[model samples]
Target chain A: MSILEATRLVKRFGPVTAVNDVSLTVGEGEVVALLGPNGAGKSTTLHMVLGLITPDSGSIVLFGQELARHRVEVLSRINFAASYVDLPGALRVHEVLDAFARMYAVRRPRERVAELVELFELGPLAKRKVMTLSSGQRTRVQLAKALLNRPRLLVLDEPTANLDPDAGDRIRGLLSALARQDGSAMLITSHNMREVERMCDRICFMSHGLIVASGSAKELAGHYGAEDLEEVFLKVARG
Target chain B: MTAATPPSAPQALTLPPLSLAARRMRIMGVVRRDFAALRRSPMRMFEVLFWPTVELLLWGFVTLFLQTQRVPFVVTFLLGAVLLWQVLQKASNEISIAFLEDIWSRNLLNVQVCPLSSVEYLLGLVLFSLGKVAFAVAVMAGLAFALYGFGVTGLGVGLVPFVGLLLVLGWSLGLVGIAAVLRFGENAQVIAWSLVFVVQPLAGIFYPISVLPAPLRTVAWFLPASHVFEGMRTVMAGGAVPWDRMAWAAALNAVYLAATLALFAGALRYARRHGRLSRFGD
Candidate 1:
């Protein structure tokens, strides 16, 4: 079964439709990338799926249950991270992690926090307040928070946007590994096509509140008669 | 180190959804996090203490001078009004500012996305404010006793119902501030600090409601705090507990509280509908 199925979803803010009939799916253990330029409604669609916003029309089903009917139940098994949303800066890193662990009610919260702390390489930084951390460090902390629940469905928005190349590559590797884990599916939105190629099993290119094209890297390249997904994206985006 | 094996198509974790007990724990977790932040920052804690302390000291001296002038009901009229007003202001401001703290720190989006429902989040703020009020009230009351020889304990157990109604009124005002912040964002932050006092003139706290001009007295009669303050005057004037007035205050507070909560819910729905929730900090 798909972990997330958003069907015929539409959201409008006054005259501008943020997401228009955007239907998509992320199957069990699959990693899908939603690629779009700014204002393509990628973030808006993600917000609707997160139950942070209500779509004007259509439905979202996560884990075989309708979101409208069972949002809190569905949300308990899902986690989201974005650079735009942040943990409280006054809090120490481990304190923030521990607090979320308790909120998510993870089994063996202390052990889970310890494991994530080690996995995120946050040992030395754990005691410091989140405000003291650099941007790259904050991204790692957000990623750790997203993983705190061992969520079955993980949604990330521009997860590695501001990191240095090494940190970005490390995050891509970590996410790739997590996506490969059993019982988990991921949906990521990013502007970086190379990162999409490295991490996603399928790509949905969005523009002006619509999914204009969708395919794997090789398929998209061959379809567009291009060198790679980037060129395919350039063709689809500009056209 | 061994090479990593690819994950098989295994069964999903299928952890049971959060029970009521788990949800309560989540609320406590939020409260604990907020309390811990307040604990670490002595300045923020002092910010909560500073206003009430200053208000009490300022009025304590006034009441001391009034006693020499032999003002009528000096204990109940001036000291009582100031102390109770402090409780109302402290409770309302504490809860309203707690909501803003999440917004200023850009943490509201994260908290909202979790399994925490809007009601649960509101309850957490209320719980956190309860702690703040309890601590502040104790400190203020102690200082009133030491400085002016008047304290809440002087009212005996009659204090319970009075404090309860005042808190409900405060929560009502606090929720209105929360609704404003959600709808109008940071530009509306001033509402959190000043909304309650906008009704102060009509509340008839220091003076009796009869002292107001006819039209203003009509407005004052609608305020729950007016009834509570009048009840305080009644108690000081050798009357009974003023159960009828207390009942009126509680009833008015009930309607106000319900309306405030409804407005809060509607404001949240508006924020989500317009995509303002994420941009609230901006």
Candidate 2:
């Protein structure tokens, strides 16, 4: 069984169906990118997979357990990080990580916090309030929060939106290391096709809440007969 | 000195009550975050401290001028006025800010997505807001004691504890208002405007309840704050305690609080069912 799986997911807002009967899967150590334009239900599908929303119709399973009913059971082995929202700007960087670490109940949490701080190069900013950190630093703190649990399944939405390319590159490297070393699976939603191409083993192009196409980055590009993944994204979105 | 295992490493660790722990952890997380925010912005703490003092000053002066001469009821009224208003304002502002803050910065999504349930969220808000009210009330009491100089007499003791119930009742009402605000957003402003109308005059802040018109007096008797004011005056000024009357007020407040909590829970379920409990913080 996959670490994460969704079948025939649907979400509706009055007359508009935000996520329309979408199904997908992610296995151990795999990285899948949910690609689509704005309002194309990429985030919505992620939400259902994460068990944040009860699907109008369909099921999401994590380790063979249903997500909607077993969110907490699945949640400990899973954690999500996103840039749009944050770990409360008021908390100090160390405090935020300490708190999530405690939430995940990391044994001997202080050592775990120290390890993540060192791993993310977050030592310098530890004492400062999160609000005082720069955007890139905040993203790093968020990434640290997600990893605090040592989650087997990590869902990241636009994980590096505000960072400089250097910071972005470092993050990409860190995520690759996690997947390679820890056998962690991730489902990332990003508009940056180039980053997606570099990080993702497989990509699913979703449009109007359905998976229009699915394959590896190069495979998708060649199958769509486009020069790059971005063109494939544009082609899928335009359709 | 062992060669590093290929990146695909494996290790096993067991978990404890992850669900229950998540709720407690999330609430504690909120407390940590709020306290941190408080420290980072001394200006915000100052604003909270300053506004109550400023409002008290305004009403304190108004009471001084309006009294013509200090009748015993008016003196007692001023004390009740300050205490009761403090509780109401404290409760209203905190509950209002809870959901509004989430919507404001769009952190509602982050919080909702966590393993936080409606019961956990409500418990956190109640515990956190009441904790703030208690601390602020103590500070305000100290200020009042210093400024007013020992005026009222014996058994001024029970008054402090009695005032706590009043605070809870006021906050319960504020919570109900918060529910209405979440399910229907436009009413927030309307509720704000109505807050002043409902609380100030009817709250029996400026005059004795006996002096109010017969119908308004009947209405005032039903308010938990009114009984708190009356009970405080009885203990402080040797006025009548009116146990039967205070009993009724406590009873009414208990019912109101239960109803308010019910409403809040119902509203949450409705929002979730409607998908207005949106995960993206929309």
Best by lDDT: 1
For each candidate, the DockQ is 0.51, 0.34
What are the lDDT figures for the candidates, one per model? 0.83, 0.72
A126-152 per-residue lDDT for model 2 (tens digits): 998887899899898888878776788
Chain A TM-score per candidate?
Answer: 0.98, 0.98
In candidate 2, how many Å is residue B254 off?
Answer: 3.6
Candidate 1 residue B25 C-alpha distance from true site, Å: 1.3
Angstrom error at residue A144, model 1:
1.0
The i-RMS of every model, in angstroms, reads: 3.4, 4.8
Error of 1 at A96 (Å): 1.3
User: Model 2 over residues B1-282: C-alpha lDDT tens digits?
Assistant: 111122212242213535465567656656655555556767767866786777656655665665667544454457556766777777766666655666665566656655555665666676667777777766766665666542333335555546666767766767767677656653464573356347567756655578888999888877877776667666656655667656777797888888988887776656654666554344
Tens digit of per-residue lDDT, candidate 1, span A107-167: 5566777777888889999899988999889999999999887788899999999788889
* RMSD list, candidates in order: 2.5, 3.9
Error of 2 at B17 (Å): 3.8
